[model samples]
Target: MPTLTIRNLDDRLKQRLRLRAAQHGWSMEQEARVILAQVLETPAQNDGAAWLQRVRQRFQGVAGDDWQPSDRREGTERELPHFDP
Candidate 1:
């Protein structure tokens, strides 16, 4: 395995990474490796599709054919409030 060295990273970002690694019970190096692998392996379309699938799955029951969008036309003609000095 080859060792990687990163340069000029922000101090805050490093702290955030350390905190996140601790939250996930990982060493900073292991967490970085996992993040790198995930980012490299997943294509953007696949990531988007996966996210859409998860959302659809979550609302599958409420998203039935009976659903209807409410009208936005009612507010279109409303007058703006006059601010008098």
Candidate 2:
């Protein structure tokens, strides 16, 4: 892991970060990290349909129609097993 030194950071921006960190109950450093990760994070695709299309294009004519299960779709819930204590 490398250390990042933000030199000559603006007072207002730093104060805002402090407030945000307090709101989220995080340290300033943790808040900065979360902000950085969120800003730099690249979403696979905003539109799920577009993402599926891209996957299909990448695997175009590869083989086997049964590779994708018809039962599989996003947000399908399964019941969790109850544990006896």
Candidate 3:
């Protein structure tokens, strides 16, 4: 088994940790261990694509209004055709 030591902890932080451990029915050491384990674990990416898709959909709706199309057409300025009667 490996042991870790944390030094220079502030009194207020220690008190808060003790209170939180008591509230959760765990010792301070155990609480810290569990928290550290959770912090080090990789978060699941199951919903990443869905979240990206939703963000893209939202931006797509707003993108049209945020940019204007260029005025030039076919390598020249656009001109209306004249009609003869």
For residues 1-85, write the lDDT of model 2, one tens digit per residue: 9999998999999999999999999899999999889867956476798889999999998988568766666688878989999
For model 1, give the 10-residue run with minimal summed lDDT: 63-72
What would the per-residue lDDT of candidate 3 be over residues 41-76, giving only the tens digit for each residue? 845545798778878978775756658777666488
Q: Write down the TM-score for model 2.
A: 0.49
Write down the worst ten-residue block by lDDT for model 3: 38-47
Model 1 C-alpha lDDT per residue in residues 1-85, reported as the tens digit of each score: 9999999989999999999999999899999999999988877755788889888989887846887777878678877899999
C-alpha lDDT score of every prediction, in listed order: 0.89, 0.89, 0.85
Cand. 2 Cα-lDDT: 0.89
Separate clash counts for every candidate = 0, 0, 0
Q: Is candidate 1 or candidate 3 better by TM-score?
A: 3
Clashes in model 1: which pairs? Answer: none
What is the TM-score ranking, best to worst? Answer: 3, 1, 2
For model 1, the stretches where C-alpha displacement exceeds 4 angstroms are 46-85
